[model samples]
Target: MHTPDPHRHTPVPPVRPTRRAAALALAAATAAVGLVVAAQGGAGAAVQGSLAADTQFYKDPTSQVVKWVAANPGDSRTQVISKRIASQPQGIWFSNYRPDSVTSDVRAVTSAAAQAGQVPVLVAYAIPNRDCGGASAGGAPDLPSYDAWVGKFAAGLGSSRTVVVLEPDSIALTTCLSAQQQNDRFASLARAVTTIHAANPNAKVYLDGGHSTWNSAAEQANRLRGAGVLNADGFFTNVSNFNTTANESSFARNVLNALGNPGNLHAVIDTSRNGNGPAGSAWCDPSGRRIGNYPTAATNDSAVDAFLWIKPPGEADGCAAAAGTFVPDIAYQLAQNAPDPSTPSQPPSSQPPTSQPPTSQPPTSQPPAGNAACSIAYRANSWAGGFTADVTVKNTGSAAISGWTLGWTFPGDQKVTSAWNARVTQSGAAVTATDLGYNGTLAAGASTAFGLQATYGSNNTTPTAFTLNGTACTTS
Candidate 1:
């Protein structure tokens, strides 16, 4: 979600889009390290204060939602959707250059937040070779240019309580760089942390820790150390991904411990889009993911400073729309589907799950290929042209299915427009829904659910026949 501009550096050259397979491989590799290799926050005055009222308004006038709301006020979802998008806090990204105006631009936002008794949360994303020169690539042309830019960035924080999420994917994706490149980056990051606090002694800077599933605690901690995290206020996890708070909190503890548990080092978790955890390993704009914890400094855990909205909802993560472009429809779906923060859901694993033999669970008396019995059921609520539906899948067989797909034909022209908790693809009159990593493996005689929303012209009839994988599911 957070990437640097490749054009600016020129030398780094834009890298290819990250394939899901490659990401999963890295995640698996690092995940194993956290479990087997052994395991492993801070308080500062500048970090003091509640998250400034993020009213997602004014920060980006040209944002997609702004245009959608003004033009479609009569649309039934306008008020709720618009308010949801505008009400939450979004990180103010400092991606573009203009050293002359950078200081003033940042100052204006910080000053406004301070005047309103709120803290300004800024994202200093102008790092060299950010996002491995992918999606959101754009940074200062060179090292000196970056330093000057960060200098101007810190200059804008005029003594107000501030939380800076330094760079996203900057540390986690360093594997894409050469050895020299890595050292230079780490050095610059270290300087950036020092430079920021030097300019505004009241600012608390947080370095990136990738995400719980992305990097091994020891690996990330080593990087944090080399990058001068000891000089920083703390580090943050899950900046742009959807790993849950429980998992992130545990992961943060591990990283801190790996870093020698320095006193007063606190970590922040990005609660922006982790509502449903992750829909499998699908990272870029996967459907079914929802908003998670609201911005709060009251994490109760001393090691965690707050659950922040480092990544704003509605912004496409490259695939759904354009990376960083806020899409009103996607934003509205996430808000509408968000779970009640008060109600406790399935708790995330306290420790990372270790790989085990496939037969950990007792095997069925008679297991056979394609012999899993599966069934699906659907329920929906609709208004106007928009509707949301939840589909439930059940397995009644002697064998468990490692992965499954459900397909059906819409009775009418009703078409799925967006979905979550699963991967959805539609063609003509038929729709195919596939499992995300989280819900892919269904045990025999067990059930799981996924949801989607669709638009209709004159009809919105539910599809009657559903199949699991290729076999038909009997309707209850």
Candidate 2:
């Protein structure tokens, strides 16, 4: 929780609408033109349609939305904007929480994703006194500690494609801090962004914008400027928080307007679980919500860069479920909240278009710099309690291997314990295994072994199904 010293605070002045209109216009146009995407956009509470064809994978890969969208192409809202954004290389945000060294895990996932051609989105949310006693609490011990932690984080980048969404609510929520504390926080933030950008020139960094409700345009811009938003790749709006796309887009544009940067100040929205919009202004693990649009790279409004699902849908916010824990119930709720698919025989549904092809899988193998070989073996190097196992990798194809990645699905019960050799990334039950700092480049003719130690309450059974380089790997 962010606690402000009441003694040294200056009263907040009222914001003039005249200064905010242009921002609002840009956002309104995005909504009006259906740039809002899926079923969560229309009337009758929530976007009153079915989920986009691709969203069904979010629930049970076999859900109806996936089938409907696959069957009917023209009906879904074209996710062109999302596609455009997903196409761009960006960084993923990594908030400090887990005690285990996730450096390898995060890098493995983001690096593999980059190798496969998609930019991984990362958020770094571990600044001291973060959130200033707001809904999101807990952070690194202090500035020096945070600075060091960020150094490790920068090292983890290791040549992968990514986009970094810097701390969310860090600036806007710092209203209660003393001038010195606020200044210190912003300086640290600037340093973190600068360090990460320096580590990887390909990485795009964005500072956070608290949702539309929290900060006004001028105030946000002022806060962003203070935090060195000028040095960031751009600003991120609505990360792991509540706010409709329309509202956030408008707010972001206004903030940019106040800062006086037009197209250069691009904004990305957290469309992860906002399809039903905010549940009556609630922010903490609110009920009656659905997964927003899946991550994508298309943005119709010129000012907005792209709409992204920064927060992985179904990941809780420290309420009802432990923060960051994947809850099946929450996943189900989000899936239910996804708009139902529209059919020609019935009334129109407002679900957004899904760009992912049917039967598509995340990538596992990456092409080398010059060759087209696909031989990579991925493994789970470690788990929570030191329980580990090693899997053998094979280069099934004749093509010589340069870079390789392995992706798999963990049994519903077990989670990762510890990993080495490569990064380990988890999305729901799906795990995309990759080579870490110790091991990345691979030789086509040879086979490598990697595994993780896992501790489960119950005993295991058969080997889980897996995919390599986005293609299903068949057991020989």
Question: What are the Cα lDDT values of the candidates?
Answer: 0.63, 0.50
Residue 82, candidate 1: how far off, in angstroms? 3.4
Write model 1 residue lDDT over 1-476, tens digit each, in one string: 43222111011111111111001100100000111111101122222323222211113332335556788889877776665554444455666556776787777667766666666567777787677777776677887888888888889788867778787778888868888888898899999999889888878899888866555678889988988999998898887776666667877888999999998577877766665565544577777666665555545456776666666666677787666555667777766654333332322234322211121442323223456587777877665655667788899877788877788998987887556556689999889887655566878788877666576788888777987777877876
lDDT of 1: 0.63
TM-score of candidate 2 against the unseen true structure: 0.53
Task: Output the worst ten-in-a-row residue range by lDDT, candidate 1.
Answer: 22-31
Please give each candidate's TM-score: 0.64, 0.53
What is the number of backbone collisions in each predicted candidate, taken in the order shown?
18, 70
The candidate that achieves the highest lDDT relative to the unseen native structure? 1
Deviation in Å, model 1, residue 275 alpha carbon: 0.6
* lDDT, candidate 1, at 271: 69
Candidate whose TM-score is highest: 1
